[model samples]
Target: MPKVRIVDIEDRRFRVFSSPTVPGGREFVLVHGIGISHRLFSRLHRVLSAKHTVHTLDLPGFGGMPRPDSDPDIADMARDLAEVLERLGIGPVVAVGDSMGTQWVVELGAQRPDLVTHVVAIGPVADARHRTLFAQAAALGLDSLREPPSANARVLVEYARCGPRWYGRQVRHMIDYPLEQRAAELVPPLLVMRGGRDPIAGPEWSRAVARCAPRSRFVEVPGQPHLVQHTAPRPVAEAIEWFLAEVPQ
Candidate 1:
């Protein structure tokens, strides 16, 4: 089991689940999307931990972490993430995020280039074409239908923990974040990935997100849904490995 630790940042708190380090192995950080927690990345954490150190984060206001007095935008969450990494003394890591988590990691890479060596966006969100709250909600609804039972159950449980009030507060930030613009500004190599069948981060949007980055590659995992990382951990892990191999470490 990964060691779980609580890191407090002012009025907010974060939960970090860390796997034992492997000597000479590269570090990897996993960030979950909106209304979810580190539990969503459990499978991916298991796979990555086999070869490298893995840290899964439950940012403030989600994953049973204490919610701040007020809502934070994407950049605020990114700063909190950076602080956790700095406090943990882990840096220059391959930062991987799913859905809105992509925005957080992208902002992290843009704000603290020294902390992240690479940014992997799995099923990135806020498709340039459908940036409205209703459009994103529809996509998420459709994705729920496509996800496997286990994945849906996990998401439901996490959502219940997050509560509708908090989820509502965060969705606005997720919808408003300009991920493509941030990706273009990121100094680290970017890997944009999506499930071939994902409705939220469709093929064109994923490609566009990748194209925004000077150094980026796009990969599609076939027959998977939005939460591809959770449902198809091995394939996602393989795709990340391929990206890492191609990227100049």
Candidate 2:
């Protein structure tokens, strides 16, 4: 079982699930997408933890965690994530994020290069061509059709726990975030990945994101949907390993 803890950063609270560290293995931090929690990364965590230390976060206002009194934009959330990593004494890690979580990790890498060694974006969101709420929602709906029932069920349960009010508050930030711009500014190497069938993160956009980074690569998991990590953990893990090995550390 992973060690679970509640971490408070000023007014915001976060829930973290961490696995034991493997000797000689690098550390990894996983951040979930909007309206979801660390639970979505459970399968990926299990696979990655077999060789590396994995820490999954349930950001404030998601995963049944208490929300902050005021709304936090993308930058604020990134700063909070930095603080959490600092407090935990885990830094220079391979930070992985899904969907809107990719925005957060990009911002974190841009703002605090010392804390992140490499950044992995899985099914990154808010495509520049389709940044509107309607566009994103429509894309999400289409991706749902591609996802397995198990992936959809976990997303639905997490969304319920996140609640519409908080989700609505954060979606605005997500849509407004300049993920590609931030990724371009990152000092750490970047890996932009997407499910081959993901409607949200299209091939063109994923390639564009990879192009933004000075040091980056793009990988596509064949026939998977938006929540590919959940449905195809082994493939995702293998891609990550490949990226890390190929990229100059």
Candidate 3:
């Protein structure tokens, strides 16, 4: 896992993780949620890395990197990701995102359709029905109750490392991102997935995302929680693989 430094136009350096690409194999890029880095997707990455080229990106300010002088919104972060992939010469890869990371991928797909072949959003955030901060917090709390102790412990550590002040700022951007509206503009295929037991991203919200998009699908990983990628990597990976094979041309 080599760390690739991506310097944005503002000269902010973002360290991203990259895996070696296999000849004639599918390409995948995994984006993690706010307050956590690529570490959360370690299990999922390993499962996919066996057969596909997987790149795990750690946006600036997360995963031990220095925070930018100013916070960047979802669109800005999406452009940074596109620039990084462009510099690396990677093209039209499947982008998988978790939680708030989903918003970034949606923005990326809408902004750079040429760079992304498809997008998979797992446990996406800011459900329209529960748009308020308090409602989102309540849903997260409910999901936390369903998640395993180990998963909760990991999140606690990651959140502490992220620091309350910085994490709060990022959450504001996340909750404010208009995911459904942006989803409508995505040219690439979109797949919105939610864990059966995930309260953060319910079935209704996931389906709404699919409905808004021109080419999209919605799936559910049963008996999984908010951290399905960590707890149910096989199922999540299988779903993504199936979607990739069925993506519209």
Against the reference, the lDDT scores of all candidates come to 0.92, 0.92, 0.86
The TM-score-based order of candidates, best leading, equals: 2, 1, 3
Task: Put down candidate 1 lDDT per residue, 1-249, tens digits, no spaces.
Answer: 788888998888988899998998889999999988988899999999999999999988888888788678999989988999999888789999999999999999999999999999999998876788888888889999999998899898989988988888999998888898999998999999999899999898899999999899999999999999988999999999999999874
- Give the per-residue lDDT of model 3 (tens digit) for 78-158: 998898888877767888899999999999989999889998999888887677878978988898899889788888888
Question: Residue 9 in candidate 1 has what lDDT?
Answer: 86
The residue-by-residue lDDT of candidate 2 on 1-249, one tens digit each, is: 898988898889998899997899999999999998898899999999999999999999999899788898999999999999988888678999999999999999999999999999998878876699889899999989998888889899999988988999999999888888888898999999999999999999999999999999999999999988998999999999999999966
Error of 3 at 243 (Å): 0.7
| RMSD, one per candidate, in order | 0.9, 0.8, 1.6
Clashes of 3: 0
| Superposed Cα RMSD, model 2 | 0.8
Model 3: per-residue Cα lDDT at residue 45: 89
Error of 2 at 166 (Å): 0.6
Task: Give model 2's TM-score versus the native structure.
Answer: 0.98
**Candidate 1 — which pairs collide?**
none
What's the TM-score of each model vs. the native?
0.98, 0.98, 0.94
